[model samples]
Target: MAEPVRVRRLTDQEGQRLRQIVRRGSIHAVRYRRAMMLLASGGGNGVPVIAQLVAAGEDTVRDVIHRFNEIGLACLDPRWAGGRPRLL
Candidate 1:
């Protein structure tokens, strides 16, 4: 069977930064959800529960986790290039 997904242990700075994001400011809701997911996973929540908690699908949750694992905290701000070139 496949192993469950989990975030690596966060440094004190990373944990603090995540807490700040979760607590304040007017960041996009997507960032908020992503922060929550990482924080919860770091605290031992699994992908399925994190998905339900954030109202997202399990696959989406897995993707977020994988992104964070691959690129650290930047996963919170996915840079989607602006919508495909408009078909003139």
Candidate 2:
């Protein structure tokens, strides 16, 4: 069987930041949801459960976990590409 997707051990600072984001919440929905995914995974929740809890797809949860592992807290706020610049 494939290994379960999970977040690596969170640093004190990362844990605190995640907790703060989950606790106090963020105006940015994506940031808040991603924080929840990481925090839940750190607490031993599986991808499916985290997906249900966060109302995201299983793939999305896995993606978030993988990204967090790769880039630390930077994964919480994704940098989406904006559309083409306006032609004035």
lDDT of 2 by residue, 9-87 (tens): 9999999999898888788999999999999999999999999999999999999899999989989887988999889
Candidate 1 per-residue C-alpha lDDT over 1-88 given as tens digits, one digit per residue, 9 for 90 to 100: 9999998889999899889999995368989999999999999999988999989999998898889888988888968798778786
Q: What TM-score, to 2 decimals, does candidate 1 have?
A: 0.88
Model 1, position 10: C-alpha lDDT score: 93
Off by over 4 Å in 1: 84-88
What is the RMSD of candidate 2? 3.1
Q: List the residue pairs that clash in candidate 2.
A: none
Best model number under TM-score: 2
Candidate that scores best on lDDT? 2
lDDT of 2: 0.93
TM for every model, in the order presented, reads 0.88, 0.92
